[model samples]
Target: MSNTQPLAGHVVVVGGGVSGLAAAHFLLEGGAARVTVLESSGRLGGKLYADEIAGVPVDLGAESILARRPEAVDLARAVGLGDDLEAPATTNAGLWTRGRLRPMPKGGVMGVPGDLGSLAASGVLSAAGLARLPLDHVLPRTKVGEDVAVGAYVAARLGHEVVDRLVDPLLGGVYAGNAYEISLRAAIPQLYEGARGGRSLIETVRESQRKAAAARQDGPVFAGIRGGVGRLPVAVAEACRSAGARIETDAPVRTLRRTPDGWEVAFDHDGTRETLAADAVVLAVPAPAAARLLAAESPGAATELSAVEYASVALVTMAFRRREIAHALPGSGFLVPPVDGRTIKASTFSSQKWHWSGAADSDVYVLRTSIGRHGQEADLAWDDTDLVRLSREDLGEAVGLTAAPVAARVTRWDGGLPQYPVGHLARVTRLREHVAKLPGLEMCGALYEGVGIPACVSSARGAATQVLGTLRRAAEPGAGQ
Candidate 1:
């Protein structure tokens, strides 16, 4: 920090996920006198976690980062993981429809076709669906009011088949949300803005693809750490501690009160309660936790947060002997459309996708399948054995893998992904506007902007910057809130 930058009093950051840790990093970098990160869980990293299975280390949570967006990669490099960044060995993916797996069509954004011919060749859509897809080019411009659902808009333009067979599964995999309900503005702002301006929504998607393809000349579209993306929070926590920030695990904040000077936070530690005074507080936790902590200070924000629904998801990671599985498992894996009524939503060929994971055990092939999404919590209610059984069942049908796995592990994430309903962005805006009214209070996390790691980091950076700026100005000769 420069001499001119005032140390923004003590900051107490709730939650020790990647967002909270990243906030601590930025806050300390911006000259906070002190920063204390409180994590309710026994460990950090939240959804980004790694563990060993069958003698091979694999990401049990989120594994990849969208390198097309710079926030995550930038933070990785900033935390001294620049050289550790590695792109996936194969980006090619598949879509399982028509009772078989087909190559995921190229030249599209979120499965919205850019080139109809290629989309047809992929055989992802039926003949009738293909005939309906071109109708988008001649359809009258649809007025997309303030905001609309992604699936609703896409279905209207390209036909319900495309939205059901293509868009839903693609977006569903990312958000764990129903595409018909996820906000167009929040999930795909480019598509929203393009739809508002362009004569044809399909044409707009094609143009967006063209621009993205041209920009890809710089580098790959996605990246992962040499070990796992889970290392991010660990690295960020280390950086924060090195910069004089205190971090505590299993510290669940209980109360948040506005003080005359700043704020007071109460949390439990070692089965005992403790209080911490801070000049500012960052609520970098999930919606439910944030709502509970903010009930006293900002009930409106609390109420709004309470309404933000989340989806539960579970991953079944399995390892099989390379020799036992003679059938070729092509591509990274495949996405299963909900219309197919499948138990597993998607599968990733971990060994084929990441060199680090593959190199762990050359004789073993590692793969993982995800089960559950928005409105599909019941799917995760099954025991680990059931999940593994059904996942293997799907693998048998999809990839002809009948051999029993050498090992399998099920990791369940309750309330893992936050859903972005139609009015989500407006709700977030209102929350921020209300929070801005409270001095020394800020918000950051996946629930606010996006569910991706990069989006969470970006949100944390913005919150940290705003809090630091406010503190710096307050320290001026004649400053007022």
Candidate 2:
């Protein structure tokens, strides 16, 4: 092992997903001598892929980043791709209720009843359901400090109507996990704070609304790259290369070990075994993969990492002639409440949601349907053909598509999204503590904090700063001698 000084040595970033890529980009920008990104697959971006279908670009994995989360936008700007950003066509999404697409109850913050009149007027709740909502005003506030499942929290305050009709579908669409198993505190801290702040959730929401109304406009609601989200990773990779970072695809890390000098990373590249030594290392892979890489040195952390469960999901893209569909696909997308007993969880009007895809005269409509949630038994069972067939059937029934699709594609992600269960934050906190004990090491990915693109970028940037600080400290005399 070479006992080179930390500042003069390399930083190896495991995994080339958005998190890893962002970490490498930050490290390079912070003046790291050499940054090497090791991607497990042939591609750099882990789940971000945009492919052309019938001459139209379709995103298979991540679709858009919330403009409210400035991390992604800032990173785009730093990479010189900020000009390529495009806002979402519409923010209005609805629920498939009673065989009709009903607009989401207005003034509700992700399904929490912020306004009773708006919820009642939306036609989502019955007279009894509307009556149950006011009970929240009188319901006793939770006194426990421990985490509460989203299901219990919403059910207790807003009634089951709010949980089943609104929160479940909205959260299910995003996390793809059971509301009963998701922690309200971990999944949505703002909602939890609001609940704890006042005696009633309705009052809390009213206060939040006032604050939001008073705040100045920040930016767009959501934005995506002109072509697709995949442009983000492409631009990040280009930026890393320009900053003298080495990126190698198909270089899956097999193991990471701490040595007297620094860290050693063993991986395979094109059927050959290779090892690289670095002063610092960032394991930015998914929880499972990162766990495997760090299992030897940080067994406790690795164990906690491996404990985070991931749900398999498949994105089925179908295209049709505009005239072939009966209902006009409005808004960005619509989510199916679990009460609907629908195999399709959510459907995004791809062409209508973005400005780039659809044309007025083309008569082409694209739909991206998501299937398989955490507890929902997958109808297709990981088979691409079956998934596509199920998606088409569900879409046809829901959207009144009488004719077969003009084009169809399926992207299956086995264990793609990490499930943020009830105890997610505590588990992550423990893992972070364990990781901190391991010198020159960091972990960042969708599993730890959030699943969104901006969250991943934020994690990467944070990890990079920590790693850079460690390197700076070690460069001091007698620090790592």
Candidate 3:
């Protein structure tokens, strides 16, 4: 594999989400002769959509990038959006449990507290629950024979109160999943590593914190585009085009097949059918869609991909007078535990979180509430008007605000998040093993590594690298022999 021009031939990336766009951009950067992106919808960004509400631009889909990881931020800068990257005004988060807002405890891994003093001060846990925490050190070392549920393991050590109140809300915010079912290794890798460490979970977390602090990682953990995260795809698509890549919206891939030279991709555009042959192919769509396209080629991999489940949720963005809010928003947002029995699971004070989201007059306040979760889809059945009403009702109850919203918009994201259940990593490993047998073909997205913006971009880069490696090997003498 000595060839310098590893990706010298045509490559086609299916799906126009951030992952696919990143893949196309990387392929072009890797010296591919040509790259084409096929997006089924009329739009480019799949889940990172941007729209205006009350004359203010707000993200209807993914709004933040976990800036701690360099993938998403680096991709943004590579696409000429470095000047527009903006960090949150505040990163403080709150927990709405026990009919009150409590400061989220610091030094917790997925809500598993590493410091006793912070947990005690936060008052998120009751006296009984707080008393149960010290028992973790005295109790015998809990054996994690294999992968276990995050809730089950944490509850065994720290008690269920922590899992229910702090952990559930945080996990739900990201995955829309139940903590009792989500995988430890896949969802929260740091916590999983700490759990397996020889020391107690608390000690393990404290040690991890010490290491991080010594590294002096000081900055906002998240970043967002000034306009909206939706601008990311547009910028990436532009970069791909500048590098001579073709991006086609309204193009849905129907089938993918292996050819003697490389791959044959079939798709539809504008009510007409067409086919394209490429030296390599990247499938960056959701798991279900990828499964359908791969069914004829590898049934085992397709079955595993089809088994991957998704969660749906809706966001209700509302505009209100800043003075109308009864309670002070000390933090960017507050997370509501499912145990709270509230209609909304979480809410974000967009104006406070990002400066660009705020109104010029400072009288208008913009915020959004999230509804529905992994096992909870009934709430999403309501129409937009009903959703807005329900969101307002919950907001009023939480903060005692009686004023009505001036304008509201409801955005429903069906199958927005992929759930990672126990054994998910194993299934992903098996899927990759099967896929490796098919040269010049690769896949990447939220279903595999993680569901965050950074993870998706990282996965896409990995797929592009794998395709490049395959191309390099094929160009080598006696590669197939």
Report each candidate's C-alpha RMSD, comma-separated, in the order given: 1.6, 3.1, 2.3
Clashes of each: 0, 1, 0
lDDT of 1 by residue, 268-336 (tens): 999999999998999898899888887877889889999999999999999989999978798999999
Q: Pick by lDDT: which candidate is best?
A: 1
TM-score of each: 0.97, 0.95, 0.96
lDDT of each: 0.89, 0.82, 0.88
TM-score-better candidate, 1 vs 3: 1
lDDT for each residue of candidate 3 in 226-327, tens digit (9 for 90 to 100): 979999999999988887788999999999999998999999998899999998999999989999999998998899999999999999999888788776
lDDT of 1 at 181: 96
lDDT at 475 for candidate 2? Answer: 75
- Pairs that collide in candidate 1 are none
Error of 1 at 442 (Å): 0.7
**Model 2, span 39-139: residue lDDT tens:** 88888788888777767887888989878778998888888888878887777887887687788887767687787777877888878888887777666
Task: Give the Å shift of residue 82 in candidate 3.
Answer: 0.8
Better of 1 and 3 by lDDT: 1
- The stretch of ten residues in a row with the least summed lDDT in candidate 1 is 1-10
